[model samples]
Target: MKRKKILFFIYTMGKGGAARTLLNVMNNLDRNKFEPMLVTLNHDGEYEQYVNEDVQFIKLEAKRLRSGILPLAKIIRKEKVDIVFSTIPNYNMVAILAKMLSFTRAKVVVREADHVGGSLLGNLKCLVYGRFYNRTDQVISLSEGVKQNLVEKYKLKPNAIEVVYNPLDIENIKQQIEIGELSKEVAPIFNQNEKVIVTAGRLVKQKDHDTLIKAFAETNEQVKSQLVILGEGPLEEELKSLAQKLNVEDRVHFIGFQDNPYIFFHEADLFVLTSIHEGFSHVIAEALASGTPVVSTNCKSGPSEVLANGEYGDLCPVGDPKSISEAMTETLTLPPEALQMRVSKGEERAQFFNANKIVSRYGQVILNTFKK
Candidate 1:
């Protein structure tokens, strides 16, 4: 049997959720049955070290999307790639166009990474999807909500879209958490006996760190807890200003980005996500796997599904600081035994997205696509 060549394409290799999820899938692909290769707009990224040495890596030197079309097409034809699995709307559009320009027989599978109609860029992508998305061989969505948006809002055939959740490397996360140690910069913050609450993501509007700060401020002053936000973004100064305005700056610690965030999740009394929207949250799964109870907004697509409608964690209304504050306080105030039960439930739920299982699903999709 001839092994299929699977090419994973993305805009960057940066420390974003989409990039990390792609790396997880690429690293776990069945090497015996498939040849995995990576193509990035630029070769540089924090995740470059995580790529499996067995896989071939290509960098299109183009700084902009328009310049990469011809290069992408050329590589597709030259490699005789069996399938081009692309993520993010911009790259997905380019992938389909490249497949057409190259006239390659390889199937182009585009994965949608976020909720449609969630933002201006998202709405614009919906417009593009209506026009060029069906031209691709398959469309993969990270959550059922995302798939429904593609079918209902974008008017794509429901049968043509597949829902594949992000794969979480549970064992790897556990191992990393075990070996990871807190940085000296954050040591003073965690040294105290106060209860700790944590959230990790890029500090952007999408993350809604302002709401998180407000919610933290609303919590009882007697609760003696600290909020630690991991990851960095453009909203750093604004979030800090908001924290100061709310008089919680001393308790709300912005620790920037960390390569291994599982340790913080493991050590925290609670993990929360205040995102306004999400396709699927890998951090939620990571936190659950670390046995940390979570409190997240009932965002568009992911939190409700990942939390199983509040079975595994607390879910509050999006952007409601008061509800978030109450949920956080409730979780933090739960008895030790009750909290352990929630943590155990979370651990069981986390297994559903284990890397082995999710990767096998992708393998089946690849095989079925070729058979067709």
Candidate 2:
């Protein structure tokens, strides 16, 4: 029997949550049943090396999104793709438009990767959400909160939206954690006898690392802990300066982006997230799978769901340094037995987002696109 071909579209295969989740889905799909193809705007991302040999990879090399639209449509028509799965808002719009221009029976599934809340692009974004989004065969939302936002803000029909959580390669994460160790430069930070707190994400306004640094400063005053930020972005110098101004620069380590963040997640005493909003947080789930306790700001959609409303980890109010600091101190100070119990429960919670189970759900969604 001929296998169905699925083309996954994204802007780039960068070290972001959506790219990681998309790669996980592509690598784990049943090869016998489906042929996976990845299409990116250009071949400029860290994840390019990780693409499976079985997956057909293409780069349009378009300088911008508008320029790539025609090339994408041509690929859709020429390859006779059975389905097109696209994530991120702008990319989603491009995929939908490309499918329209292709003029083929191939289905298009646009995945919404964030809670736009109707303000991201102002009127233009809202118009696209209301017009083009519903026009697609299906819309994949990362959480119930995102789905609700679509319906309320954009007035999308509920039946057209499906809430699909992002998948994690939990087994590979555990393996990497087992074999991975701290580098020579970073090893000393872990050896300082200070309770190590780690957070991984781009240093941007959305991540709200400013609040995290402040909270870390507060946590350090009482706990003798250190903060290790694992990702890099525009705010690097500013954040480092904040740490210095707060007098915790000696305790804060900006290690940039590590190829294997799972190692840091596993070795750290605690993992924290201070994002302003998220579709679904892969890092929190990763920390849970790594057997580390987590403290996260209760963001719009993902964290509360992943942590099960603070059952598996502590959830504090967003952008509140004092509350976050209190939670950090309390979680770090839990008794050994109590901490172990929470970690065990968190490990179980993380399994629900495991790739093995979540991939099949995506497969079903892809199939449903054709039916509609």
Best by lDDT: 2
TM-score of each: 0.97, 0.97
Give lDDT tens digits, candidate 1, residues 5-120.
99888888897998899999999988888999998886479888888899899999897887888999999999999999988888888888888888879998889888868567
TM-score of 1: 0.97
Query: What would the TM-score be for candidate 2 when compared with the true structure?
Result: 0.97
Which portions of model 1 show Cα errors greater than 4 Å? 118-124
Candidate 2, residue 173: the lDDT equals 96
Structural RMSD, model 1? 1.4
lDDT of 1 at 241: 92
Clashing pairs in 1: 231-256
Cα lDDT tens digits for candidate 2, 50-166: 889989999997958988899999999999998999998788889989999999988888888777754655645666666888788888898998888788777889998999899
Query: Which 10 successive residues of model 1 have the least lDDT summed?
Result: 116-125
> After superposing candidate 2, which stretches have Cα over 4 Å from the reference?
118-124
